[model samples]
Target: MRLMIVAALTLVCVAPAVAQDFTAAPNYGDVRLAPGFSPDPHLVVVQAGGSIDVDGTLSNCSGFITSAPDLRLFWDGNGSLDLKVSAISNADTTLVISGPNGAWYCDDDGGDGSNPSVTLSSVSGQYDIWVGTFDDGETRSAVLSISELSSF
Candidate 1:
């Protein structure tokens, strides 16, 4: 009976941490691109920050992001070029990406100033991305940039 009680308690504790769903439709929009596509950097304006806290969810993952992804990227090309995803905001921003390989990558302050950037090497397929804020439930205007050469 004690073990059963413990199991139920554990399930309740773990439920909230699993709230972020990468499969859900994005808040911004989706983009399809191939290697060597024109416009080296594709930009999208977005609102960064949400209620979901990702600090203890995974190693190197921090900040607060929405349950739904902010953007979805469909890359139609061979895995030959590197892809860089970044966010530029006045407030401290973070980034989280679910790669095509089912791997999670996060970055805080990897770009200029308080922005965040994550670079994936030899990438293809779908990338679900979120631009988050360092603080919880604080939304800020941010520009998400997808680039092959440089980060903004």
Candidate 2:
């Protein structure tokens, strides 16, 4: 919560200088969201199951499911983003979040059930979010949500 507040303040302080263009903020990151991408966050749901290779960088994630899709989030340095995911039907779900910085944060059981969540504070950029399952053959339904907690 404190981080969100700080992020909010940061956004407020910077809002006056921000340009009206929707392009990625200068020096924020290498990723500029594709054209027509929505700046507002939305709740997304996708199907997950089967298997995908796991990288060693993520310590706790099982792996991205075969048919599961990735969600692209574009942040224009406005404020903070709280990324959350839930495996509504299956309790064995895990999450993998990869930012433009090439870092991945993995989590399991952080949500209401066995869901996962990651928070981005004071950073304006894009991220690739993946939902994975614990077991190779396990399949389930999951919901992905991102919140722009504050825009100044």
Best by lDDT: 1
Error of 1 at 137 (Å): 1.4
Candidate 1's residue-wise lDDT over 35-113, tens digit each? 8877989999999999888886767789999999999999976666788899999999999999899899999988998
Which pairs clash inside model 2?
Answer: none
The superposed Cα distance between candidate 2 and the true structure at residue 76, in angstroms, equals 1.5
> Candidate 2, which segments miss by more than 4 Å at Cα?
1-41, 53-57, 67-69, 81-87, 149-152
Q: How many steric overlaps are in each model, in order?
A: 0, 0
* TM-score for each predicted model, relative to the true structure: 0.89, 0.58
Q: Report the error of model 2 at residue 58, Å.
A: 3.1
lDDT of each: 0.89, 0.53
List model 2 lDDT by residue over 56-87, tens digit each.
33455565454323555665654433433333
